[model samples]
Target: MTFSIIGRCQESGQLGIAISSSSIAVGARCPWVRAGVGAVATQNVTLPALGPQILDLLETKQFDPQSALDHALGANDYSEYRQVTVIDTNGRTAFFSGKEALGIYTAVAGEQCVAAGNMLAGTHVIEAMVPAFQNTQGSLADRLLAAMHAAMTAGGEAGPVHSAALKIAGDPIWPIVDLRVDWADDDPIGQLDSLWQAYRPQMQDYVTRALNPTAAPSYGVPGNE
Candidate 1:
């Protein structure tokens, strides 16, 4: 019912996740990133806690992606129903897809990234995502969105994906980008793309507003008038 990619930008040292699913509010459950730590995507019969837990391991415990994933998966009684992907700050990646993960499951790992899907149209859904992310020339967020677009073009989930999310973490304590289409009967990916386009230019403005409101640009809203 879901497919996702977790990746790091080698040049900028940012981490992010792009995900979509037949389920609603997939953003709230599947993707997690810690600034200067790592990124995680927990899907299939998702254990949302696993996402943060893996990041905590990578950050606080100094565990590599594989070690963090192994520690987390080992403790779970229902590991077979879960699918997870992890990438550490150093771009080391690891992934696991349990035998019980529902229909057409696969996980593909590439330099600085991992893509995973379950209940997909085919393995190509994830296969297409990796190269798209690796080859796309842009910011980490742009590459992530491109990967999602590629996945959708490759046939996407076996059923309609109602929710989609893009989350990226840079140097800030909060995410540099966090966009979501909680539910849409059609094209959540397109909606997310539009959101990204609107956000890109203003992203630095948002950070500036947080750190120095007086120097920040105008709110540009009706209420400001």
Candidate 2:
């Protein structure tokens, strides 16, 4: 069981997804985002391939979120077992929760943001994330993480979530933020947020190292020093 939020930042045009699940290594399966394309989260029965496939439709195939979702799910024999959500460059969102989605499933679509979950505690689990994503201050990563925390407070999955991930795509060829707590017997969501906190201040430095090594800052580690 999993719950996730996908959002596009209005000011930066960045896309991000924050997700947590009862399953192990959930990050390795769900939550995909491309810098200039879009974001997608495929859960429920969890066909991991659908993440990249839907992103392809949004990028090269000239498909909107809704069309891409329709085309992707339409082709799958087990489509009814999937719960997928999509958001594109234009801030449009599309979400589908198949009939066979796990217990107490629901979704919420908000401005430039959307969230969905299967085996959630209730619809409020999805509903609470919307306003948190909308009103939270800071970067897109910050807001996405905030929404994730809100989901837990609102009553998360029908069961305790053991794994979590949050990813954000900026202008770089690589992800600006990709943090995961693959499996935590305790609170994976909190651990994921703590990672974001540790990573945020250094995010730009990593990009600088990649794009222009000479201009990058010191690593502040033993060998690097």
Candidate 3:
């Protein structure tokens, strides 16, 4: 029901995740990232807690991606029904697709990224995502969006995906980019891409507003008017 990629940018040291699913609001549940730590995607039966659990292990406990995934999955009784992937700060990766994952589920790991999907048209859907992320240029968000497009080109979800999300964590305590189309009748990926484009130019303004409101530029909103 969902396909996603968790990746790290080697040049900028950013961690991000891009995901889409037949289900509504996949972003709220499946993807998690912590700056200077790692990223995690928990799908299939969808244990939302697993995403944070993995990140916490990586951030606080000093566990690598593989060990974090193993410890998290090992503690779950329903492990057989879950699918997850993790990428650490060092670009080390690990993944698991349980025995009970839905039709045509598979996972692929590339240089600094991992793509995984369940109830997909075919394994190639995930396969295409790896190179797309690896070869694409520009921001981590751009590469992630490219990977999502590649997945769709190969044969997206088994059914229409209503929701898509892009999340990136850079040097800040907060995410640099977090956009989502919670539910869309048409193309969620395109909608998400549009949101990124609109947000990109002002991405720094948002952080400026947070850290130094006096120094941030005015958006000329209703209150400012």
Candidate 4:
């Protein structure tokens, strides 16, 4: 029902998440992230509580990626129907794919990133996402968008995706950039990437307004943080 990519940016110290799903309103059900904490993708049977619970664990420094995931998985009975990936603030990453998950899914961790997805066409789908993000250079949001594009090009979910979203959180407030194509035509991934790119400048402008109000354009100036 869903395919997601969750990770933290090594350079900006920001966290980014992207997801696409054949089910309507995918963003509402999957993909959760918090800056200065960690990121999580909960799918399959879906455990929404794990999203904030994992972030709380990371925030208190009570556990690392592996242990936090272990603790969360240990406390849940539906572990077999769950898929979760975590990338902590320090860049440490880990993930678990339930044995009962649909189709094929794998979570891969590298020096600075983690990539995970299910119901993909093949193993290369997730494999291509991370390397593509690593090989590409720019903002963390751009890299995440690239990863999503790579997965889609490699054959995303077994069926057409109805919804897609990208979330990046950092200092000051909730999220620095958040965009969602809750429902789209046949090409949700491509449309998601386009929305991300269009929103980048606005994000920068908003940040600028936060830090230096005079520098922001009258209309571009964002509200009080």
Q: Which stretches of candidate 1 lie over 4 Å from their true place?
A: 222-225
TM-score comparison, 1 vs 4, better candidate = 1
**On a 0 to 1 TM-score scale, where does candidate 4 land against the true structure?**
0.91
- Model 2 agreement with the true structure over 41-157: per-residue lDDT tens digits: 999999988888899898875788999999998877799899999999889999999999999998899999999998989998999999999999989988988898999999899
Residue 75, candidate 3: alpha-carbon lDDT? 81
How does each model score on lDDT? Answer: 0.93, 0.91, 0.94, 0.81
The residue-by-residue lDDT of candidate 1 on 1-225, one tens digit each, is 999999999999999999999999999999999999999999999999898888888987568889999999897789999999999888999999999999999999998999999999999989999999999999999999999999999999999999999999999989999999999999999999999999999999988988988878886797642
| lDDT (Cα, tens digit) per residue for candidate 4, span 1-225 | 676777677667898788888777778867778868888878877888888887778888989988888888888788999988888888888888989988887777765677777787887888888887888888887888888888888987777788888888887557888788889877887888888777776787778877898897566336634
lDDT of 3 by residue, 41-74 (tens): 9999899999888998998856888889999999
Off by over 4 Å in 4: 208-216, 220-225
RMSD (Cα, Å) for all candidates, in order, is: 1.4, 1.4, 1.4, 2.4
lDDT for 7 (candidate 2):
97
Instruction: Find the 10 residues in a row with the least total lDDT in model 1.
Output: 216-225
Comparing 2 with 4 on TM-score, the higher-scoring candidate is 2
Q: For model 2, what is the alpha-carbon lDDT of residue 112?
A: 95
Q: Which residue pairs of candidate 3 clash?
A: none
- Tell me the TM-score of model 1: 0.97
